[model samples]
Target chain A: MHVMIIGAVGMLGKKLASVIAKTRQCNGQSVTRLTLVDIAVAETPENPAFPIESLAFDLSHTDTAPLLTKRRPDIIFHLAAIVSGEAENDFEKGYAINLDGTRHLFEAIRRERDRNGNAADYRPRVVFTSSIAVFGGPYPDTISDTFFRTPQTSYGTQKAIGELLLEDYTRRGFMDGVGLRLPTICIRPGLPNKAASGFFSSILREPLVGQPATLPVEDTVRHWHASPRAAVRFLLHAGTMDSSRLGHRRTLNMPGLSATVAEQVEALRTVAGNDAIALIRREPNPDIAAIIAAWPQDFTADRATDLGFRAERSFEDIIAVHIEDELGATSA
Target chain B: MHVMIIGAVGMLGKKLASVIAKTRQCNGQSVTRLTLVDIAVAETPENPAFPIESLAFDLSHTDTAPLLTKRRPDIIFHLAAIVSGEAENDFEKGYAINLDGTRHLFEAIRRERDRNGNAADYRPRVVFTSSIAVFGGPYPDTISDTFFRTPQTSYGTQKAIGELLLEDYTRRGFMDGVGLRLPTICIRPGLPNKAASGFFSSILREPLVGQPATLPVEDTVRHWHASPRAAVRFLLHAGTMDSSRLGHRRTLNMPGLSATVAEQVEALRTVAGNDAIALIRREPNPDIAAIIAAWPQDFTADRATDLGFRAERSFEDIIAVHIEDELGATSA
Candidate 1:
């Protein structure tokens, strides 16, 4: 079996690649070939069980999709996207990369299937990483899987469009697709980027590492979260799960721990004591607060739960997962 | 004020143009110029109070959208699309016209806004005609505004994508847009097309005109509907309604009458007597029956109703409107 990971240079992409490299398989089949692609040249993981090929790929260009599909990887993990803040700031760039690029990639697969006489048997498993941002405010307390997607940001709109295309493509038998609407990754293992939700991770991640962090929103501001480990697990599970279980809808809201800012702080206190809690400074930024206000706070991801997907049970577990995975420590 | 109507050569477009021409206004504002565009040369409506121009415009071509937007019509009624059956048969053609074409038109508007220094105040009122096909089966008895859109057909997917784009563009302040998810237009004036839902109109229309019509499904098959006249009214209202009322969501489930085939037949009998009803024949085509079975049966269009948009109250009223408008009489 062969597998391809788009956006392989990003933090999650890199982590996913390392995991797949170590296992040498996905869902049980031996992965003999691994293709890692991103905007910048991706590094081939050292001494994987199978052959690894790294390539620079940009989906915004029309010709890039065809080149990427030429290998006809058995499974494709599409994680590439413009971050939310940037997507909102630059409308054209966001749609060009997020919307058009995804559409072109789907079309490329369709064309490839038709080009060969084996269109009847050409179907690849597509695991797409969507976000909870697909739901806007004026929402219910616990958003159900069947709730409408009224994205307030351009990035969310792009993802929503991608979800629609994915379902239609899957229905037409061009691909076997499953989209996981991921929650914000708690303790993202990287330096802060331009996303407004960066503070969610920074407040916890920075303090745990003995650094100062700012809290932009109130202690009561709640949001959904999962660790990097859980996100990777979701992708692998989606790739192998029975598409028949999903029926006509190709996407499901991923299960995650919904915690308020105070709960996260309390969890931090339980792990690292008063010293770590002191590192969190309340530097209120109204702009960031306003953006967070419109975001989804909680969800009843019943569909995904029933489908065998799991997540951390508590904020403490989430923090511990971050420490164990990122800091290489079993306990704080 | 100036107005532009895409797909102006079709039935609804022709009726809309004639209405606007007769009134010389839309939303209480005088229409000084009218631009009618379609894949074929649109026939110019004669003796209008305003100046009218007809042109052959195919949106599938990249250059056509920009050219159409050059005039910067204050109101744009975007109703162009390939019907369901054709889109299902030809995948590439559907995406080209429905997806890419819509995107290019929105882009053209954005570019025009930025071209001059008046970007802040150049937002046009875009009234887009979406369809109830955006909602697939596994639906509640009465689908609400908050139900998720899980389109089962290629046409539905295209329209769903269009709705997402329209909302994003409006949110970005590129344009003031309102998308109306119109139910199937009943008692359609023209000849039957390739649409699977064509029978919904044909069964009612043909018998009213003293011609035989076939029913492809059981009498219990329920579906949502509104008259073509009501559809035109909805578009006109959307063109003028205050965008402030819509909040962040740009689309609404349009108000429509929910009736079963039995109810439709009963209404037909009331309008044209048992003699006309005898013209109807039961010829079950399993292919069409399976297609219609997956469609939405009813909707609670509360949002549209609260916003002051109205439709025919009953199936009898719908039949009456068709008779008065098309047959030039209150009854056959």
Candidate 2:
């Protein structure tokens, strides 16, 4: 099996690559080769059991997609995207990269299938990373699987569009596609990216490591989240799952823990003590608060749960995963 | 008020144009000019109260959108699309005209807004015609406002994507937009188009006019529908309505009558007598039946209803509408 990971330089991408490298397989198939692609060349995973190739390509450029699909990887994990805050701030750049970039890749795959002559011979499993951002507010207490997507941000709109394209292309037999609407990754490792939800992670991650982090929204503000480990699991499951089970709706609202900022702080106290909670500096930013307000606070995620996807039961479990994985802790 | 219709040559587009020509105003504002655009030059409406220009253009061409938006009409009615059957048959043409074409028009509007210097100076009302095709089957008894869009066809996917763009662009303040998810127009006049739903109209239309029409699906098949007159009213309402009422979710499920094929035949019998009903031929084309099966059968368009949009109360009313509007009947 040849596995390709787009946006492989990003935090989740790197971790996913490391996991794949250690496993030496995907969906029970032996990994013959692995390809890591991003805007910059991704670093090689240590002691990989398979041949690994790294490529730097900007998918927004129309030509880049064809090059990426030239080798026809058996499974393609598309995690590349302009983060929410950046996309909201720069409309054209957001559409170019997030929307056009995704479409170009899908089109490339379709063209490759056409070139193969036997259409059935080249259909790859395309695992697309979507986000809860596809949903907007005035949401029910628990957003159901059937909740409509009325995205308030350009980034969300682009992602929603990508989901539509993914399902359509998959239905047309261009590819076997699965879209995972990943919840915001709690305690995301590394420095914050431009995503509006970055603070959700930064507040917890920075404090646990004895560093001060700004809390942009009030403690009462609630949001959905899952650990990096859970997100990676969701990706693998989507990549390997039987497409027939998905029916016509290829996207799933991933199961996640819903926690308010106050609850998150309490979880930090439970896991890392009072000093860690004290590191959280409350500095309200209305802009961030407004954006967060328009986001979904919780979801039923019944469909995903029924499909065998799972998430942390509590915020402490999420923080524990971050500690074990990123802080080099053997046990939480 | 300056009005522009993108698909001015289409059945609904022509009717909308004729109505505008007769009204001499839109949204209580005096009509100044009307621009009609299509792949072919549209015929001018008879005895116009304002100057009207018909232009032949394809929106899929990148340059065409800019030209259409050069004058910046006060209200833009984008009714252009590749119908469902045609879009499904030709993949490239579907995405080219339905998806890219809509994007180009939107981009053009945004650029035109930018060129105006003050972002507030040239914002126009963009009325986009979406379809019930955005919702697929395995549906609720009556689809609610918050039901997710899982389009089963390429044309539907394109419209759902367009709706997302409309909301995002509108939210960004580039243009004031409203998207109406029009139900199938029943008892349609003239020759049937390539839409998979064409038979829904033809079965009623042809028989009423003393022509034999094929019924490809069983009498048990249920579907949602509205009349051409009601569709025009929805467009006019969308074009003139105070958009602030829409909040962030701009697209709406327009009110429609839900009826079975048997019910439609009964309505036809009542309206045009038993002789007209006998003109219907039941051939049971499985291909068309499969496509129709995936379509939405009913909707509780409470949002659109509360906002003052109305459709026929019964299938009889729908038949009455067709007879009065198309058959030159003084009374039903």
lDDT of 2 by residue, B1-332 (tens): 89999999999999999888888776566778999999999999776767999999999999999998988899999999998888989999999999999999999999998776867788899999999889887888889988888899898999999999999989999899999999888878889766778899998888877999999999999999999999999999899898999999999999999999999999888888999999999898999898778778889999999999999988889988888899898545
RMSD of 2: 2.0
How displaced is residue A62 in candidate 2, in Å? 0.7
The 10 consecutive residues of candidate 2 chain A with the worst lDDT sum are A23-32
Write candidate 1's Cα lDDT for B106-220 as tens digits.
Answer: 9899888888777786789998889888888788888989888889989999999999999989988899999999988998887876577888898888998899988889999
Q: TM for chain B in all models? A: 0.97, 0.96
Maximum-DockQ candidate: 1
What CA RMSD would you report for each candidate? 1.4, 2.0
Q: In CAPRI terms, where does candidate 1 land?
A: high
Best by lDDT: 2
Q: How good is the docking of model 2, as DockQ?
A: 0.90
Q: State the lDDT at A267 in candidate 1.
A: 94
